[model samples]
Target: MNESSVKPSEQLSRTLAAGSPLIYVVTWEEERLEQMLARASQELFGDDRPVWQWTAALGFTSGPGADRQLLDPVEALSFVVSESVDAICLMKDLPALFESRPALVRALRDVYDHLSVRPGSMVVSHPSINIPPGLSKEVYLLELPLPDADELRGMLGSLNSGFGEEQRVSDEWLDRVSYATQGLSSNETRDLFHQLVSEKIVDVDAALAEINLAKAQLLMKENCLEVITKKYDIDKIGGLSKLKSWVISRQKLFTKEAQAARIDVPAGILMMGVSGCGKSLAAKTIPSVWGLPLIRLDMNKIMSGGWGAPEVAWERAIRAAENAAPVVLWIDEIENSFGFLNDSATSGNMTIFSSFLTWMQEKPANVFVAATANRIEILPPEMIRKGRFDQLFFVDLPEAPARIDILRIHILGQGGDPEEFDLNHLAKVMNGWTAAEIEQMVRAARIDAFTDGREITYDDLIHNIYRIVPLSKTMSEQLNALRIWSHNRATKAH
Candidate 1:
């Protein structure tokens, strides 16, 4: 889109002049915002620049003397109302103080009302929305999204101007950088681009990767979302043809081509089953399958802090996930995270869970949430709603055939002769064992062989199985409860 097409400031000015006063702009880039305000000022007053300055060092003084005075938000707001400063008064970093200082919110509202009747205008700019309840009616909130492709291209062109051989950079690389930095600030983009060049990995793809890493860090801090860059393809994982096929069927829906064709991307999937099932593996491997990075939301980090703190963390986490779009967000042990949703004492937790459910219900198609849970009973009904998750599949312990596949995969990975192993006999003997337990038994057999200075044999596996107890045995009641619940609600993993 062209710069002319995205004139948010012009829209804001028009709104204010049309009698809907008090524009509140939420944006991360203070510098870009100032440029927008300057453009708006030029649009408002021809030839004469509208005086604007922010900072408490110099108080607000308009016209000839106004250019030098820097004032706090309250003081600037007061000056705008009292002195009738025709200029648009811009305030930065004021949202952090709005909630704490009721008086300031009241003052801004008062100034807004004063400007509503007069010719003057005031604009509040911050990276977040913090309008006080009292000022909600007076303030009009607007989001200044990150610069679009054209704006980013213009920035790159300006940055490269008058530079010699050192300024060498490919248009494709710049385009990739622009595409990667969908929610990043101008400074973040510059820092990331230079970091790539400084590290001498200036190739287009590498530069895009570097930019992505920076974005991951910022989004991680914002949302308590852990960006998992470790590679795990379907090939790394053994066969799960059914599950793999399910994922492949909707893969095209996530692409730009699919979006252009007016197809809605699938919301997400919920994988529930017994412990040691390949649910977790499927969650991790999805990023590789979709060619997107994986992000694991750390509930431990999210749960820390006093009352009402989790709300901030939750919002930040969701924002982070949204920012890292066209990616997989894995919430392992999702049961534990929302376990308290039904309890009255966990109002905060419930609030957090509700927020998450709402996000999951309405999240952009690009954000594929792979949430896994062992205890489905603890999960709230809202989470399993059709719109929240496209499909809910039960990932029970591998059946006879899947177990055989799992065994072959494990044995081949360890250089064992699958032909010599009695796959049918082993499957029958390990009826209730999970894929994890089977793997453990295999490892135990290997250990026995190494300890005895002999080759691992079927006898070693049988001996190990005798010594180990599976989840179906130890947590029989819970396993039975889950199985019964899944009878009508979930798709059984064969």
Candidate 2:
């Protein structure tokens, strides 16, 4: 938990050199962490100090007690001592054992304290570890970063080595493979390569599908989030001309030309608007139009008690988003999810909130965040003070012209020809209605068309439109309050 800018690998080296008793690595990448521990062992204690690894299933390997199996975690933790031999012990998946055994925890603490001056170190690696408060001072936590572009490139090059010169990959293929493998752990990337080698094919196009398949599998296993595939074009969005223009201009920020000019990536947008407006749809359109993958975070799932602890669930969701970087992350109904950013939140909420703020400020990945909220009043000032989001746009009820656009878009989508319906007249009649309400009206008209057993008549649409009321009409007071809150606070989206 040291708040330094040094890399995690460098942090581990420094800790071992300083004779730190126990180093806790919080990661899922045990394979890569082994490489770090091995390098550190050589650097700190020369080649003579053996780097030992232990698991409940396979214990005490590559050290003085080679081939010896210490299945008991307490017995295995004894390697942390033994001044006669300098050993770097890697503890794998010991959290479950520690949770059930209190004596092992005491032994770990005792061994940690006793090995203060010895040339020995204990490295515990787990997906998530709950260290006892008693050993908090003795244990130092290290975070293993996800594979970067250079590491990915090397991994892909290894795969290419298996192919002949005639099948050697071009620079473009290698670049695409590296980019596609971004956010994957070192072990995952290696698995991808192993699969490629087994299949005896290394086509770049096929690699993309396999990489995404791996990502989809990872997401399916997560309890706190779901993956949303981009299927719509940006033009499908009805209104928000101003917002559309902003996105079109900012699209250049990601281009090679913009990079040449040293332009930074836009932070993202916060679309605060009335309920049923195009806020959520607009967020999707931005990435869809840009040909970028998109993912939506399920805040309800994240806050669900069924998904383990809320803080842990939230952390997993954040890491998932990071892994799916260079993609737009949509968090809908933000205020209802995170609550006011004011300091008066529950301890769990505060931890989640702080983690988000820290990531927004210091995240190294290129994940573009697009958040939407219906109730801006509940949001705290610190969240919107600046720097978090590039712009805050207010999406109110569509005006007369935008209503026509929404009607046409939805009608065409429902396999109905817009030319048959009087869109201009319908737009005027559906005054103060949100885009979502208009979409439902279109569906209602289609149902009426089927009920009549004939081609749809304009009267069918008009009749159905009168039966349903929009959110603005049903919740006028609340809508007005939100409008007032966003007047000076946000830019007009339309």
Candidate 3:
């Protein structure tokens, strides 16, 4: 099934209408899920088929036994079975009880049996999926996705209409604000919009920045995925003409017209080659070029078990990245992270590896993955294959021309005039230098000139060029092997 094309509400309504005796919805947005359930209930079963909500704090909040104190899980299931009304019962705070209370599990199974043949359905909602073995077969899982752009846009419009014209933002700003709130829940989105209106911060740039800041904070709580705030312009990066052109050509695919035409979104490219050769910089630049948010996945954290088991933590991180759709997910030094894909891989590592391959192949179109690797030889063949990544480009050591471009950029960036230096001569002298090395050379030269109380001169840069040794010389054997590997396997980025 094309999960991306189908709306969550439609999926829920279908499941409920198909007489799924018990449904397990995994999501943190209980309020939003309830709203969807209420609407789905009315449409699927008419006004008479009421929607009931139950929580440990307020059992039977809305239903036949309004405000009834059936805090016990077994008792709650008993009440639902005894009532047996044609209704939708939303049971919150019940997943955690499955393991500790076997009686509650058996009771839920009974409720399932009772509701299977009837018009009623029991929905268990929780922030995560944790079904005990006994009731696994009886539960149908449905994950509630984060709010999409259209939904968020409608929400922004609804909130904006409540304010005076003087405080209102333009439709363009509304679109931007909606995109900015991609990863937030409905309640959080509403609260953010409320804050914006209350504070009268209707300026487009400032409001969007505030929204992104809030989103980054919330997403960071997951511990594995980080929202990258530092922006890099694609134009700032030197050379890689082919890769840059390819990226630019696909920018149209993200446009409204391209979406209307139903063009496939680019899966993303894999950049494999020397370290410090601008692979990571290219990953950071893509989001800025496309006007999308950038998220970095910390593989080390996933393996650390700080969030949970590696598999569980991986799922959480992937879900968070997908939630922030129309975003770039940068996975840097992927080979080092998934090194277990080698013969030494454990059963757990193999599971994660297989799952990652499948996810890369089938991930949502909006979640563009810009992954970089310093050791492509360590990665399994299946990972770098065609379908997994749209293209694999080898980022080699900067050629003389690219070295000159890198030098010029870093020079201008450091408040020095590139024209003052003999770039071609410097590029030659720093032969085989990585982009990162060149950047450092320029920085060191600027410091030298500053200490000497003069503007940066060509001699300042020349002095550092002789002082620093490039990675191409230090790791010549590895660099040669990488070049040979990419000759027949990947396209050249330069």
Candidate 4:
């Protein structure tokens, strides 16, 4: 909702007529809510009348006099019962109380019963919905979203108060701040702005960086979401001819051109293959290659306890990605996250997983996803099913010709002369080794030569190769099984 032009009095009128006596305003910014309520009270009841409110520690009191009591939610509820026609019992952290105390539940029921007969109501404000079954029928919930550009501008104007009445923060600065604070609440936005001012870093870019850091922490707390700038260009990654061609073909689909052409950019790609074959690299690189921002989702972070549902966190992550549209979302090693969604034991987690699955399946066509998995066997079949990914590609170990290119690329990258090395001998020696193993061997050889204070030689690399056991030797059976699985199912990257 646009909070810029929304006057407190108008919002109060809407709250008053809402059918449910218990109105829950889900928002992270308590100060904004407080300011709105205070302004509404001044308009409706006038400064002369007392408005009794309560809080836990302070028992009960009236009007602004009850500010201390209102800080403790139980007292606030008690105060609502004791006074004021059309009064509001504003409770904070009421959701937490609902889980811990059945007495609070009964007390709330009693309060609801009284409010049904009387002319007043009780209101709970939280960052998210956590309605217990007992309070579900009694409470009406409304999620208050983050502050829009106009509201942020107003806040910025107020923050820069002494800058002059006619001129305040510039529209350009406001635009930057608005974008930086996309997923944050009014309180978060205000706090970040104030923090920048307090630190005396008045430059807008510094403030934007500070906000970005805070946003990173907030998204990290969710575990499954990350905000990252794409770092690698597609040209830098070698030897995925077919996959590269496929991705290049859809390049326009991720741009405004595709939007005008009414082409659905496609949801995402599923990269299935043996480990260390560039699945992860490809996923991370797509955002950069396609000129989209990248967000890496690590499912390990989503299982924590919090103020809201885990599903809400998933939705928030997905929404943030979509909000940053024309963005690439990289869900690396995704099989672990969705592997058990089919199991009844992980139903809650499964439910959350399915929500993500649905989004990936039906997300706005512009939000491209690039998910990578090492083990296709563990992934829920539905995920790899044709339509989920525009295409599925198998990233096998580098073939003979690809190995030569990969070695040359790595050697050149390390300031070594590619012409100095015996490429044919190295490729032959590295047979059955994964690209990752070849890279590792080159690193080991470099270190071996450095230890002896000598330049690396072909002999050093051969020695390194012999020293380490490659996956081809260790997991031959499994690799063969996997190759069979991918034979007809996926497009080969070779």
Q: Which runs of model 1 end up more than 4 angstroms from their true locations?
A: 1-13, 16-21, 46-51, 57-86, 93-120, 128-137, 145-177, 197-212, 219-224, 255-262, 298-313, 340-353, 377-382, 411-432, 449-466, 472-488
Error of 4 at 205 (Å): 9.5
What lDDT score belongs to each candidate, Candidate 1 first?
0.72, 0.77, 0.85, 0.69
List the candidates' TM-scores in order: 0.77, 0.78, 0.87, 0.66
Assess the local accuracy of residue 262 in candidate 2 as a C-alpha lDDT between 0 and 100. Answer: 65
lDDT of 1 by residue, 1-494 (tens): 56546556566666545655577888877778777767766677654665455544455434533664545666666666667656667766567777666678778878878877765566777777777788878887888766654566667656645345675576666655565565567777666656665566657656655655766677655546778767676654444567778887776565445654778777788999787878898888877666566789887677876323878877777777776666788998787886553453277777878888888877766788898888787777877978888888888767777778777777766657889889889888888888888888888888898899887788887899899988888998878888998998998756
Candidate 4 clashing pairs? 51-63, 54-75, 54-76, 55-69, 55-72, 55-75, 55-76, 56-72, 223-301
TM-score of 1: 0.77
Q: Pick the candidate with the highest lDDT.
A: 3
Tens-digit lDDT string for candidate 4 (1-494): 79534654366556654535687888777667766666655565455343344444454455544545355554555545665456655666677667666667766776787788766567777776888778888877665555554576677767777555444556566655654465567777778777766676656656655665676666555456777742676665557778888887776565434554666667788888888777887777776556555678656566553535666666766776654444577888777765453443266577877787787777866567788877787666877887788888888888878788878877766557889999888888888877777788888888887889888887887898789888988988988888998888889987
Count clashing residue pairs per candidate: 4, 0, 0, 9
Worst 10-residue lDDT window, candidate 4: 48-57
Candidate 4, residue 238: lDDT? 58
**How high is the lDDT of residue 215 in model 2?**
71
Decoy 3 TM-score against native? 0.87
